[model samples]
Target: MANNKSAKKRILTNERNRLQNRFYKSSVRTLTKMFLNSLEIYKTTRTPENKEKVQNTLNSAYSLIDKATKKNVFHKNTAARKKSKLAAQFKTA
Candidate 1:
């Protein structure tokens, strides 16, 4: 247990930051999955609307990933690698 006032406050702050980090990480994963799913749909259907959806998904994923990196939830190169892999998936699909 935290015996001092500062230590208690630190514990609370850590919990808050942990929750915030969790949110950003979950957002990154959700956005990435959304992009991949949209890509799969585009592959199967090959329609303009599906293509547009895929593009939008990719854009949103990129934005969220960059935000996560900026927030220090992810490293810069890790973000770049993730973005590259996502784009690669899109290309191969």
Candidate 2:
């Protein structure tokens, strides 16, 4: 329990931040999964349309990740590592 008014406000603020962070993290994961799935489809089909889809998903994932990093939801190095991993997978595919 919070002992004072300030403490109560702090608790509420922290909870709001936590939920926002969770939303960002979840969105990042969803976008990453979408990118990977599209990459897989491209690998299987080797079609220009599939390749374009993969590229678009990759760009979207990258944009969301950068936004999360800018908002301080993700550490800069962590964001870099994630982006690197995604890029590597795309290249290999």
Q: Where does candidate 2 stray beyond 4 Å?
A: none
Candidate 1 deviant stretches above 4 angstroms = none
Highest TM-score: which candidate? 2
Residues 1-93, model 2: lDDT tens digits: 989999999999999999989999999999988998888889889999999999999999999999999989999999999999999999999
RMSD of each: 1.0, 0.8
Model 2 — which ten-residue stretch has the worst lDDT?
35-44
Candidate 1 structure quality by residue, lDDT tens digits, 33-74? 888888878888999999999999999889988998988989
Score candidate 1 by TM-score against the native.
0.93
Candidate 2 structure, TM-score to reference: 0.95
lDDT of each: 0.91, 0.94
